[model samples]
Target: MIQQLLINEIDLHVQAILQESGVERPSTLKILTEHPAHLEHGDYSSNIAMQLAKIVRRAPLQIAQDLQARMEKNGRVQGLFRKVEAVQPGFLNFYLAWDTWAQRAEQAAQSLGGIGKNTKVLIEHTSINPNKAAHVGHLRNSCIGDSLSRMLAHAGYEVEVHNYIDDLGNQLADTVVGILHTRTEESFDRFGDFCWETYAKINQAYKSQPELAEQRAVVLHALESGKSNLAWMGNLVAERIVREQLEEMKQFGIQYDVLVWESSIVNAGFWDTTFELLSQTDMFHKVADGKLAGCWVLKNREDEAVAELDNAEHQGDKVLVRSNGILTYTAKDIAYHLWKFGLLSNDFVYKKWGAGLWSTSSQGSKKKIGHADMVINVIDHRQQYPQEMVKLALQVLGYEEAASQLKHVSYGVVSLSPDTAAGLGIAISDGKSSYAMSGRQGIGIKVADLLDHMESVIEAKRSKKTGISSRTIAAASIRYYLLKYQLQTEVILDLEQATEVTGNTGVYLLYAYSRANSILDKAKKDARVLHLEPDFNVSLLEEQEYPLLRHIAYWPETLAAATQQLAPSLICHYAFELAALFNHFYSACPVLKGSESSIRHRLWITQIYKQTLQQALELLGMPTPNRL
Candidate 1:
C-alpha cells in the first residue's frame, strides 16, 4: 500500500510536468518504483526519467530534475517523503519521513482486500486417485494448493476448492483386480493402506502377466455399470480411501470444499452433454479409417503436449472414447473441466460430506458452486499435454473467455533426497543424488509416515514439560519446507532438514514469533511499562526499528505480487526475511528493559511484528502455536 502511494504521486506529477511542457507522455510509460539496495540511497527509487527520455526529447537527467522539483512542492508527496532527489544516470529516489514509516508500522495488521473483486476462483488440487494412500509427492501438491487457496482468500477472492476423485479410472480397476488375485491374510486398518500395497503389486505384475492385465479392461467395463458387484465394491473402496486421504491431509491443514467423484460426472450424463457440444466442432470427431479407426478423437494442439503423444497431427491423436465404447481418462477429464467452468449443460448433485464439506452424490440437492471466473488445476508438470488439450477443447468450441481463464498450475513432481529415499527403503541406484516418487512401484514415502517421522524428531528434542504439541510443530515445518521452494522446481524433501530448529526453517521462524510474543507479554505485565502505551517521538526509533517497519510496510505489495504470479514461495521468502529482521531488532533493542521513551516504540514494534508474523503463518497454511 505504501509503495503504490509513491508511484501514484510520482506518476501524477510527472504527467503534469509533461502536460505543461506539451510533451506527449508515452502511452506505455510506466513508473517502476522499487526498494533501494542501500537505505542511505532512498526508501524507494525509480527510473521513470530514463523510460521517458526518448519520448520527451530531452536528456534523462534534465527530465528527472524537472520531476523532482515538482514532487518537492506537492503537499501529498512532501508529507510522505522527507526528500525527493534526482540522482546521476537519470534516477529518481524517494526518502520517506520517519513519521510516514511509523504510520505504516501502525497499519501492520492491514490486509490486501478487493484484489479479486467478486471474481470467483475454483482451485482443483490434491486430486489423487482413491486407489492408494497419499504419498509425499501428493503432499507437495496439497501443500501448494492449500497455500494458494489461503493466499487467494486473504486477498479477498471467493475461492472454492475441489478434490476430483478419479473413482472410475484404471487405477481403481487395478486395485479391484489386485484385491481378487492377491492372496493374503494381512488385513489393513486403513483401506487406503491396503490398496496402496495392492495397487503397486498389481502394476508390477502387469509387465509379466498380460492375462491379468486384460482383467483391468473387464473391470473397467464392469465399473461403467452402476449395479455390478465389482462396481459396488469399487464405490465402497473409493469412498473409504478418499476419507483416509482427506484425514491425512487434515493433519497438515489441507481440506477441500467439494469432493467431486468422476463417477458422478460420467454417470450423471455430464459427459453426454459435453460430447454433444464437442461433436458440433471439427476438433472432435470419429476417425473413419486409420490406426485409431472407430475411436473418437480430440485434435491435439501443435504447440502443446505433443511429446506425451508420440503420434502427432492425425496419427492416433488423443482418443476420447475407444471402439468398445469405453471412455478414456482425457475424455472424462474434458467433461469434468467443462462442468468446472459451467460450460456443460449438466450439473452434479451436491450433498454435505464429512466435516461439513460438500461432495457430488448420485442423489442430492444442488448447490451454487460452479460458474467460476477462473479454474486452476494443480497437476504434475508431466500432465502439461492433457491440460493444454483441455484448453484447446475450450477454444475450438468457441468459449474464448473460459478458455483464457483456464489455468494449469503445473509443478515439478516431488522426489526424495538420497538419504530420505534410503530411509524410505527405496533402493538408490545409478549413483543418483535423488529419486523421483513413483506410486505405481510403491517407491515413495507415505504422507502419514513422513509426518510421524518429523513429529518424532521434534518430540525427542522438546522438553517433556512443555505444553505445545510436537505434531503441530512438525506440520508447520513440513508445510514451510514444501512452500519455501519455487513452484516449478522439483523438491528433494529431507525430513531432518525440514524439522531442524535453526537456519531458514519454519521452526526457527516460529521461535522468532514466540520470542516476540514473550517480550510483549512481559511488557504488558510490568507496572513500569503497563500503563504507558506505544507512544513516542519518531526520533526515539532505533537503527533496526525503521527497517523493521519498512519491511512490514511492503507486505501488501508482497501478497499482491505473489497472488499475481501464482507463487507461494514468495510468501515464505517474506516470512523468513521478516523473522530475521525482527530477531535482529530484538537483539539490538531491548523492549521492556530499555529507557522508557525508547521502550514504548520497541514494544509497539514487537507487538506489530508478532501480529504480522501470525498473518504470514496463516497465509502459508501453517499453524501459529502458542510456543514452539
Candidate 2:
C-alpha cells in the first residue's frame, strides 16, 4: 500500500513535467515500480522516463532529470521520499523516508484486509479419479489448488472448492472388473491401496490376455446403466475408495465443498438436457460418411490456423458422442460446466457429505449449489484439449462471458529424481532427466507412503527440545516443496532435498519464524530490551536492516502480482527471499546486546519480519511451527 502511494506521487510529477516540456503525455503510461537489484540505487525505481524517451524525442537521462526536478518541488513527494534521484540513462530512483515508511509498513502489516471484490469463485481441483490410491503427482495438484484457494479466500473472495468425482469412467470400471475377478488373501487396511495394485494388475493382464478388455466393457456398461447389481458393486467400490482418498487428502489439509459424481450427471438426465440444447445449435452435427461416421462432433474453435486450413480433410474436430451413441467425457464435462455457470435449467439433488460438505445424489435433498460467477478447473496439462472444448462449447451456446470466465489452471506433471527413483526401487532409462510416475504402471510413490517417509526422516532430525510433531513438520515441508516451483516447471521430488532444514525449504522458513520467536521471547525478559517502545529511532537501523524492511513493505505488491498472474510461485519466491534477508540481518546485527535505541529498533524489525513471514507461509498453506 505504501509502495502504491509512492508510485501515485511519482506518476503525477511525471505528468506535470511532460506538460511543461511541451510533450503530450501518452494516453497509456505504465507507471511501474520495482526495487533496484542493488540497494544503493534506491528502495524503489521507476523507468517511465525511459519509456517516454522515444515519444518525447529526448535522451532518457534528460527526461529523468526533468522529472526528478519537478518531483523534488512537489510537497507530497517530500513526505514520502527522502531524495528523488535521476540515475544513469533513464531510471528515477526514489529513496524512502525511513521513519515514514517504517511507521506505514508497521501499520499496513497490522491492518491487512482482504483484496477481493466479493465475486464468487468456484475452483474445482484434486478431482482424482476414485479408482486408485493418490500418488505424488496428485499431491502436486492438491497442494497448488489448496494454496490458491487459501490465497483467494485471504483476498476476500467467496470461494467454493469442488472435487469432481469421475466415478463412472473407464478407470473405475477397470478397477471394478478387477475386484470382481481377482481373489486375494492379503489383508488390506485401505481399500484404495488394494484397488491401486489391482488396477495395475488388470491393465498388465489386458496387455497379454486381451480377453480381459471385454470384461472392462461389460463393467463400463454396467456403470452407465446405474441400476444393475454390477453397477451397485462399482458404486460401492468407488464410495469406499473415495473415502480412503479423502482421508489421505485430509492429512495434507485439503477439503472440498462438494463431491460431484459423474454418475449423478448421467442418471439425473443433465446430459440429456445438454444434448437437447446442443441439438438446437449448429455446433454439433453427425458425420454422415467418414472415419467418424455417425459420431456427433463439435467444431474446433480454438486454433484459427487449423480452422482456416483450406483443405476440409485436414480440419480437426472434437468428438462429442461416439457412433455407438455413448457420450464422450468432453460431452459430460460440457454439461457439468453448463451447470457450473448456471446456464442449464437442470440442477442436482444434494446430500450432506462431511460435517459441512455436500455431494450430488440421484435421490436426495434438493439444493442449489453449482452456480458461480467464475469457474477455475485445476486439471493437469494433459487435459488442455478437453478443457478447450468445454470452453468452446460455452462460447458456441452464446455464453461468451461465461466462456471467458472459465479458466483452466493447468500444471505440469511431477516426476522423481534419479536418486529418489533408485531409492524407491524404480529403474529409470539412461537418457531421461526424470522418471515420470504412472498410476497404471504402478510406478508412482503413493501419497501416504511419501508422507510416512518424510515424517520418519523429519523425526530423526528433530530435537527433543522442539514441541512440533513430526507429522506437522513433514506436512509443512512437503506442501512447501510442492508449491515452490512455477506451474510449468517440472518438479522432480528429491527426498533428500525436500526434508533438508536449510536453503529455501519450508523447514527453513519455519525455523526462521521460530528463531524470531526465540529472539523476541528472550528480549521480553532482558532489562535492556524489555522496556523498548514501538517508537524507536529509525536512524539506528543498519544497512542490512533497510533491505529487510523494504522487502517487508513489498508484501502487498507481491501478493497483487501473484494474484493477477495466477501464480503462487511469486509468493513462494518472496517468502524465501525475506527469510534469507532476515537470516543475513541476524548474522550481521546484534539484537539484545546493542545500544538501547538500536536494540529496540532491531527487535521491532524482527517482529515485523516474523509476522510477514507467517502470513506468506499461510498463503502457501504451510503451518509455521513455533519451534523447529
Candidate 3:
C-alpha cells in the first residue's frame, strides 16, 4: 500500500511538470519503484526523471529537480515521505516518513489476493505409471503440483487438482506379464517393490527372447481391451500400487481432488467421441501410400503443407493412431484436455474415493468437475514435444482461446549424488560425482525409503526427541530441498545437505519461526514488558528493525508474484530471506529489555514476522512447527 502511494504521488507530479513545460506527456511514462539495497539509499528509488529526459528535451538532473519541487508542495507526498531527493544523473529517492511507517505497523492495509476470485484452474500432475514405487523425481513433481494447488486456492481461485493414472500403459502391461510368468523369488512386505524388481527382469528377458517381446504386445492389447483375466490382474496390481503411492504422498501432506484413470477414458468411449470430431477438421488426415500409411495423424501446422504429407517426421506432424488401430499417448492427452475444458459433450462417471475426493470410474453417478477456465500440466522437461502436440490439437479444432489458456509447466528431473546412489545399494564402481536415477533398473530411492532415511538422519542429529515428531521435519527438509532450485534445473539429491539446519533449508526457516514464537510467548507471560497501549512511538524502532518491518508488509506482493509465475520456488526464496532478516534484527535490537515503546514495537515486529513466514511455509507445503 505504501509503495503504490509513493509511486502515484511521484507520477502525478511528473505530469504537472510536463504540462507546465508545454510538453505532451507520454502515455507510457511508467513509474517503477524498488526497495533500495541499503538504508542509506532511502526506502524506495525510481528513475522517472531519466525516462522523461528525451520527451521534455531537458537534462535529467534539471527535470528531477522540477519533479522534486512539485512533489514537496503536495500534501499527500509530504505526509508519506520525509524528503524526496533528486540524485545525480536523475534518480528520485523517497524516504518514508516516521508517521507513515508507524501507521503501517499499527494497521497495514495491503492485500492483493482474491484477484482470481471467480475463475477455475485445473492442474494435472504426478501421473506416474501405477506399476512401481514412486521415485524422487515423482516426489518433486508432487511437491510442485501440491504447492501450486495450495497457493491458487489461497488466492481465491476454484482450484481442481487431478492425478492422471495411466493404468493401461505399457509399463503396467510389462508388470502384469512379469507377475504371471515368474514365481516369487523372495518374500516382500510391499507389493510395489516386488513389481519393481520383476519389471527389470521382464525387460531383460524380452531382449534375449524375441517371442517374449511379442507376448508383451499381446498383454498391452489385453490391458487396453479391459475384459480378460489378464486385464483384471493388471487392474488389481495398478490399484494396489496407486494406494501405496498415495500413502507415501500423505507423509508430505499432498492430496488431490480427483484421480483420473486412463482406462476410464478408454472404456467410456470418450476418445472415440473426440476422434469423430477431429475427423471433420482439415488438420486431421489419413496418410496414404507411404511409411505413415494407414494411420490417422494431425499436421504440425496448417501453413507447413508439403508436397508429400505422408512424411510426418520431416514436417514435425504427429501420428495419433498406428496402422493396427492403437491410439498414442498424445491422442489420449488431447481427449482428456477436451474434457477438462468442457469442449466434449460427454462426461466421465465419478465415484467417491474418500472424503472430498473423487475418482473417475467406468460406471457411477455424476458429479460436477473438470470444467475450468485454465488448465496446467506439470510434467518433466522430457515431455515437451508431446505436451505441445496436445496444445496444437486444441488450436486445430478452432478453440484458439482455450488453447491459449493451456499451460505446460516443465521441470527438470531429479538425480542422485554418487554417495547417495551407493547408499541406495547401487554399485558405484566407476568414480562419478552424480548419477541419473532409473526406476526400471531399481537404481533410484523409493519415496517411502527416502522419508524413512531422512527421518532417521534427523533423529540421529538431535540430542533428544522433542514434542514435535521427526516426520514433520523430514517432510519439510525434502520439500524445501526440492523446491529451492529454480524450475528446469536438474537437482542432485544430497541427504546430508538437505538435513542441515543451519543452511537455507526448510528446517532452518522453521527454527527461525520457533525462535520468534518463543520471544512472543515469553513477552505475553510478563505483562510488564510491553505496554498494550494503542499507540507506540515508531522512532523507538532501531535501524535494523526497518528491514524486518518492510519485509513483513510485503507478503501480499510476494504471493502475487509467485502465483503469477506458477513457481513455488519464489515463495521459498522469500521465506528464507525473511527468516534471515528477522535473525539479524533480533541480534541487533533488544525486544524484552528496552523502553516500553521500543519493547512494544519490537514485539509487534516479531509477531508479524512469525505470521508472514508461516504463510510462506504453508504455501510451499512445509509444516510449521512451533518448536524443533
Instruction: Judging by TM-score against the true structure, name the best candidate.
Output: 1
Give one digit per residue, the lDDT tens place, for model 2 in 395-487.
888999999999998898899889888876776668577898777777778888888988998888877735678888788888888888999
lDDT (10s digit) by residue, model 3, range 98-123: 66666664344225456678899999
**Better candidate by TM-score, 2 or 3:** 2
* TM-score of each candidate structure, all chains considered together: 0.94, 0.94, 0.93
Give the per-residue lDDT digits (tens) of candidate 1, residues 1-628.
Answer: 7677778888897888788778887778887888987887787889998887887688999988988888877764738778888998899988778676666565633546767779999999999988999888898999999999998887788999999998888889999999988755787777787888899888888888879999998888788776899889888888889889999999888988999988888878987888899899877878776466787888765633222333443332577887778887788888888888888778889888977699999999989988899999999898887888788888988989999999988898788889888887887776697788887888888888788988888888876526468888888888888889998998877766766877888788888888887787787898888876876468886667778877877787887788888899998999999999998888887778868877887777787778888988898998776655
Q: In candidate 1, list every pair of residues with a backbone clash.
A: none
> What TM-score would candidate 2 get against the native?
0.94
Clashing pairs in 2: none
Sort all candidates by TM-score, best to worst: 1, 2, 3
Show the colliding residue pairs in model 3: none
Candidate 2 — which residues are off by over 4 angstroms?
13-29, 76-78, 107-114, 302-315
Q: What is the C-alpha lDDT of each candidate?
A: 0.83, 0.83, 0.83
